[model samples]
Target: MNKDHYTYRVTWSPEDKEYIGLCAEFPSLSWLASTSQKALAGIQNVVAEAVNDMEANGEPVPVAFADRHYSGEFRVRIPPHVHRALAVESAEQGISLNRLASAKLAG
Candidate 1:
């Protein structure tokens, strides 16, 4: 496993009443479950699926996650349109856009 591939963080959500999982390195891969343990298990399955799919398609698997966890931060500049969309989403979900964005980025 490469040490610089990608990492993710799983968080618990009260409104949704589930444990949400996300991987920023794999932006499209995420899952949720009723419990943290279940959510982590689900994440493992999701990762396996992603790896299997990538292998079947002859794509390189992202093995960095196996080496170390991500623990750094950076900044991004979102367009106004995207910011508005995120704000609307945050309002509808009853969560702060900052939290949502943090979760998304941590993933």
Candidate 2:
């Protein structure tokens, strides 16, 4: 697994007063540093070490989000009242429910 392909995010932590680095694939692991660059590097190194240990233990490695395929279709359940309102709104706008929902989500 290419650790570089894993989704990494760096954000400022007001409480910690430092930049926090996070890996989506390894939610339990994190690194913090005074600088965003250092925080990112720290998290990447941590993820690399974790991957090495997991490999040595013959564990299945997580597939990076960048390496995974996504289907456009997904199912969502809404309250009946909300569903009826959406249906009415779609009709008022002369659009399909899926189109209205997609537009709302994208917005």
Candidate 3:
């Protein structure tokens, strides 16, 4: 996997008083620096090293989120009461249950 293709995010960490860089695909890894740019560079380097190590060990590397395909469908289990309430709401709005659920999930 191209480490650059992995999902990256930089955020301020109040507890550490530093900017934190994170990769979604490698949740266990993070980088902290005084500036966001350094934090992001640090995390990217770390991810590159990790990917190299994994490749050397013949471990399967994770597919980047950008390279993965997703269907519009997924399953979720809610309590019966919540299900009924959602059904009622969808009915009142004259929309299908799936549409209502999709809107709620997006919000």
TM-score of each: 0.50, 0.94, 0.94
- Cα lDDT tens digits, model 1, 43-95, are 76787778778889999876564665666666789899999999999999999
Tens digit per residue, CA lDDT, model 2, 1-107: 88999999999999999999999999999999999999999999999999999999999999999999999899999999999999999999999999999999999
Question: For candidate 3, lDDT tens digit of each residue in 49-88?
Answer: 9999999999998898999999977899999999999999
| lDDT measured at residue 28 in model 1 versus the true structure, 0 to 100 | 82
In model 2, pairs of residues that clash are none
Give lDDT per model, in order.
0.77, 0.97, 0.95
Error of 2 at 34 (Å): 0.8
When 2 and 3 are scored with lDDT, the better candidate is 2
Indicate the TM-score of model 3. Answer: 0.94
Return whichever of 1 and 3 wins on TM-score: 3
TM-score of 2: 0.94
Segments in model 1 whose C-alpha atoms lie over 4 Å from true places: 1-6, 63-107
* Candidate 3 error regions (>4 Å): none
Ranking by TM-score: 3, 2, 1
How badly does each model clash, as a count of residue pairs? 2, 0, 0
RMSD of 2: 1.0
